[model samples]
Target: MAKKAKKIDIRSDGREFDELREIKIQAGVLDQADGSARVDWGITMKRIAVSEKTYNKVESLREQFYIIPRGKGGKKYLVDVPAKLLDKIGDEFGDYEVVGEHFKGNVAIVAVHGPREPIPRHVADPYRAVLRFRYTMAPFSVPERKRPAPGRREIEISKVSREALQGVVFANEYPMTAIDIFAELLSADAGTRVTAITAASVALADAGIPMKDLVAAVAVGRAYGHLVADLTKFEEDAPDAVDFPMAVVPRTEEITLAQMDGRIAKKDLDELVELGIKKAKEISALQRQALKEKYQRVVENEQ
Candidate 1:
């Protein structure tokens, strides 16, 4: 008799193999910039109620918890807690009520400066506008305070990001000019490059730059023996992890950016790329909705 196959366990965060993290995007967020957008891409861990006593002990660590009032007369203090500590406290604090939510994810803000004259006249292209992308992470963006300077990784990401969006843009319309995109990562967990690219696309559109389509991006890979979409840091650090990040132009189904880390079979690589394209289309829809909402807000304000 053939032996039954063992079932693979759910992801560490209890997500399906093809499930993406929750994403929230807002356009036209920066008043000074010609166009701007903010992308919050991450998962929300559970909210648990702890005694007022526990709250007091950790109250000084305000940065970590989001405090919410629960119960009648707002007597109970509920805090959105991180998942790392969830396993340690289990059942010891009595039956805690789920009252608040704690989000752990990446937050990126992108601003588009101009279709103005290029800074160095020599670098300007006579036939098409020059596209430039700058990607930076805040000092406090990671668990450890990252250095403020742009490192090699940042430079590489900026180069690839500029390449990714340059194709979709109708640069010929604004010759002898430069369109500059600045992407700042206020918080990061993983997939920072992809998040920045996604936000930059929206910021460009918000600036009224002509484009073939909004470029959408996502990271897909294999973790724990299963092909997955949107690998979290936990999955990215797995012993057998394979991370592949791709950006796509949804209208023509053209891949603008593709990068991979670690190894996988050819067949698996093909499957992963297909999964990335599928997820990119879903992200494209969200980008459109965010732009629509921004204009809707504008209309409401005018009235």
Candidate 2:
């Protein structure tokens, strides 16, 4: 028996499925970081890339890079890329940088530090490099101050975020290393997780980490039985709402992260996942453009 889809009429800002709130992102906002990016969604800071001298010091960190797989047997193809080409695909880290608020208001910041040496030594794995994520909300991030500590929720989100981003990174390329990401919720909002993921991707690219593709994320929810994109804090709390956040490698359409609250039918889930992919691809394009613009500036400055 087939069940009919219910009509949903609720909306916070009358945004359609294909429409998202105003989005703005700028890279290299911070001069100190190896790479930084800022978005109206919030801010992000990154540290990556090394000087020719520094490269010599950490030269052992470099490893073979691969691209998107093709053909049936799934045998991966490797390419011989020079240093410039390494930068082209974000294989090599460049200067560190940071990004801050362009539009005021409270927004999250996603910060990444190091493809460098891993501290403590114990956490380092001999077989492959490791990636760790810490998701935190500041005391003043919300209307009411939160406890200044990493709670259970933060721990859970951090674990999930690491898992989500791990797939995109060439961890094996930096064996015995650690890539640490800190996503701070400076301005609390509904989709901070998604915002952090998007910002983090830009930071990684800015840092010049080798990657197959950039990651993009968005949250979708069912309000009044209708699907919507980029759920705000208000919409996320709506009664009976189904909130789902997802991260994807747009070019490959590979889902790296997905989290859902509230039950949904299999058919609805499929539809929402497709919708998420569409939105993520759009965001990914913007990410690529940001990197392109940043590098263009670097080239111009060098000249």
Candidate 3:
């Protein structure tokens, strides 16, 4: 667990500009991979490896964007550890909708694979498009962590993560092809899943998977009863925050994910969503800028 946030030095100007941290990109970090890059955005970082395999389902070649959803090779819905964590996530989220993309400082690596079997009909939900994610903490991600095992908090974040992302996927298109996005966290931040989802989208795109749009998330936390755009792990533990772990995608300019764990008035719901949507767009814009910069370098070097 982290401590609450303290003040930081703003620019010389009196304006309190939300200090944008550095986003460092290292390309081809994996020697054997067809495509791999490590994204270090401020406290957030993800090391993604992209490799391609032939698909027997030639019919699905039309999908230029795909999302590879994977878990810890098990069923997690309403299960043991995940459920308990979800309960706590609910407790924290009850107060406010922490909006934005990615975990605070989590690092993930994603890999893409081939056309697999379709999901069985029995387990599929009629109302929801399923997006699966597995979140783990490295043996040394945190200050006092080990064993490389996830705790209740990780499970809880996974549960809500699908909701944050379902609206952005086109699962019906490539019915059976599993876009496997595997993330091994070398570090833990508040926005790992959001980071993973962003990385997953890029990995899927690199794998030639198509989608309607790119989705991104950011977390907003309350401190001293004040709404902060992105909350660090330490600040999240602060009692002032009535909400925990909120993610939003800016594709439709509306909130697709909302969850809380503390006390808040019902009237505040719309306000929180509005704030979340607003910040999500800002984060999305930054992601697009990063993507543009990455691709531009590729083009320039090719020339």
Candidate 4:
């Protein structure tokens, strides 16, 4: 018979097992990217950008804009406009009704580019869009200034975060093109991978990319043998800690990204997943609210 896992009192700092660390997602930190967001959790801060795709033709071909229904039970509308009108449309109204909730630090930077023109020819695909991602941490982003450039850790994160987002984006719409995502750690934080994924989803929407739904992510860990949502550096470094990071689409309740470290009992898996999903929904709500607030500002500026 297998030995049973020991149960330990996980509560520390007066927190409940289901409670998350304090979180804040702030959108619109930098205007240069098609969309940008910042998430602050504990001591970490993360900034992300979703930029306009590079191909002019791809952007010009789209002929519609989104709007919520006018009244109760009214269907939401996608008003078709002339292709030429889209050409006349400015960059200001691109984000529409999107927002990001929160996560951060070890300052990871992930940039998603393209859905534009394909370059170099060989990498282009005829049937669907090509997405590429790169993740890196800055030399100055850590407590001890570290060497810059891509390393094994950076590469691993890039791949996982990309996978987390691939299912949600409407990649088929831009065949023969490439969409690139880049994430850099501007500072060190325990949950940077999840934070980057969360921010990237908002950035894609902000850039007006077609997506089935937005993605949100968060980390859950076992501390003192108790399941906890949103682990911090302190908890992550704990000798008994077990970490699980996940990304999901709230509309479909689909999990696009999930990774685990340390050990978990088969019986405990269900509760951990439940906790992560519940928190993901909460985070998704905040993302929508953020977008609404951002668009509100644009409306005010226009008036």
Model 4 per-residue lDDT tens digits across residues 111-226: 45667777877889898898776767778766587778677888888899889988988888999998876666566658888878877777677667799988999898776557
Question: How far in Å is the alpha carbon of 297 misplaced in model 4?
Answer: 1.3
Candidate 3 error regions (>4 Å) = 1-38, 43-104, 114-131, 266-269
Minimal lDDT window, size 10, model 2: 63-72
How well does candidate 3 match the true structure in TM-score terms?
0.61
Residue 18, model 3, lDDT: 35
lDDT of 1 at 269: 93
Worst 10 residues of 1 by lDDT: 62-71
Checking candidate 2 for backbone clashes, the offending pairs are 30-98, 33-96, 33-97, 34-95, 34-96, 34-97, 35-96, 35-97, 49-93, 49-94
* Order of the predicted models by lDDT, top scorer first: 1, 2, 4, 3
- lDDT (0 to 1) per candidate: 0.84, 0.67, 0.47, 0.65
Highest lDDT: give the candidate number: 1
Provide the TM-score for each candidate, comma-separated: 0.83, 0.73, 0.61, 0.72
Stretches > 4 Å off in candidate 1: 1-8, 47-100
Compute the lDDT for candidate 4: 0.65
Arrange candidates by TM-score, highest first: which order?
1, 2, 4, 3
Residue 94 of candidate 3: its Cα lDDT? 28
Q: Candidate 4: how many backbone clashes?
A: 20
lDDT of 3 by residue, 1-303 (tens): 223444433211111223323344333345443334355543322111211221112124212111111222222211111122223323322232212223335566654342233256454444433445565667877668667556786777656654555566676666534434444567664556666655555554554445666565655545434555555454455554545444555666655555665555555545666666676666667655655676688899999
Clashes (N, CA, C under 3 Å) per candidate: 0, 10, 35, 20
User: What are the per-residue Cα lDDT tens digits for candidate 1 across 250-271?
Assistant: 8888999999998888999999
